[model samples]
Target: MWEYTDKVKEHFLNPRNVGVIEDADGVGEVGSLSCGDALTLYFKLDADGRITDAKFQTFGCASAIASSSALTEMMIGKTLEEAEKITNDDIASFLGELPKEKMHCSVMGQEALEKAIACYRGETVPKPEGNIICECFGITDRQIEATVRDHHLVTIDDVTGHLKAGGGCGKCHEDIQAIIDQVQGKPMPIRSEAAPLTNLQKIRLIEETLEREIKPALHQDGGGIELVDVDGNRVMVKLRGTCAGCKASQVTLKKTVEAKLRELVSKDLVVEEVRS
Candidate 1:
């Protein structure tokens, strides 16, 4: 464990507003259990559209919980428009600076707050442009690009320290390096054009995408899913736990699950449910 500031320790030991607002005006959820962190933030608005109360439910490490607690404390009393300006850096600053490796926790808090505000405004979170980069973490190219450009990150380790991008499997290191070089105007290495992926490679990518993207989102809502079969471009899966009998299970399969697979894997891929 890296050194924790006194404020981090204080918030971790006694977190604030650790429950739900039954009739909340906005709710935001982010992170995933598969990645070892998840957060759900709730806030209520007063007559004047000011945040009157805020709460959260989080499943993560000490840093994540502390960052979330700090976020709620900071969100209360601010208007939604005002709260929109809060950034991950602000969350970490409120805690007197989190360890670099734990900066993603503050990022998650900021995302949840943004999502909650979007829900309040009846707006869906637009999918950020750019493909997925870190398969193990479900981080996207847009996310890494913004993080690098915003924070002036220079190394793969710096990106990982702040975004958890290259911290898993190590396959994304080269891609990350290219992104870093591109962002800083450094000359990127010349490379041959890529060949098509083998069947085995596609399977591996599908599994990683599920682990990094799909399952975690399902897990967020007390539901779960498992890969049942992959034949040609058809992907079959079975819902588990709370998702098994959900009336919207098919919607989850098509909209959330299949859409993600298509976006991350191959556009021709189709997702179908296999009840078993």
Candidate 2:
């Protein structure tokens, strides 16, 4: 588990402004549940165009909730001009610090604020334009490039932890690496057909896939997976905790587990459930 600052825990446990502002003067929304995080922000501006009220509804991890809560508190008394100046870094700073792996939560808060300000100005923020790079998360190549530059990200894991661009099925790893290489002025490595993996390499990748792509989702539901054995291309596993009895466990295995392994490990791989 990532260690969160005391303030992050405080705000998450007792978040302020957790509601809708029906007659809100400005509203901003960001993220999607399919991507595992979402937030909506509402604010009411007083006669002098100063923020008088701010609130938020968020669906995400503790970091996301804490970031949304902190964002509202930071903007409630500020003018639109002042609030617009708030950055993702500022949000992180206010909470003391977020786990590096959860920095995207802060980024989401910043984007919501930008959208809200645009709404108040009666201007439509154009959809982000770029070729899709991370198919699982819908992140774009331009976004990856920009994040690599802004955060000085040096590795695919850094990008994944910060922006979730390469956190999914792992097919985007090479593309994200290419973006990082370009941004940092490194010579791009040759891309060739991958050599056949040894048994150990395959097992290692499977464990990594479970950790990076599967565990967090199950953990959210009070469940977990245990890798039993890897025999050739068949992966035997057992669900533990709440997942053991979940009615949707089969669905989870098919849609999430198998799909993730196919994308990240070997396309020929099959996932099967084993009883305890």
Cα RMSD to the true fold for all candidates: 17.8, 17.4
- Regions of candidate 2 where Cα sits further than 4 Å from its true position: 186-276
Clash count list over all predictions: 0, 0
In candidate 2, how many clashes are counted?
Answer: 0
Model 2 per-residue lDDT tens digits across residues 40-59: 99999999999999999999
lDDT of 1 by residue, 1-276 (tens): 679999999999999999999999999999888888999999999999999999999999999999999999999999988999999999999999999889989989989999999999999898877899999987899989878866667789889978899999999999999998777664323322355557886787788677656765677688878887889888888899899999999888889988887777777799988986
RMSD of 2: 17.4
Residue range with the least summed lDDT across 10 consecutive positions in model 2: 184-193
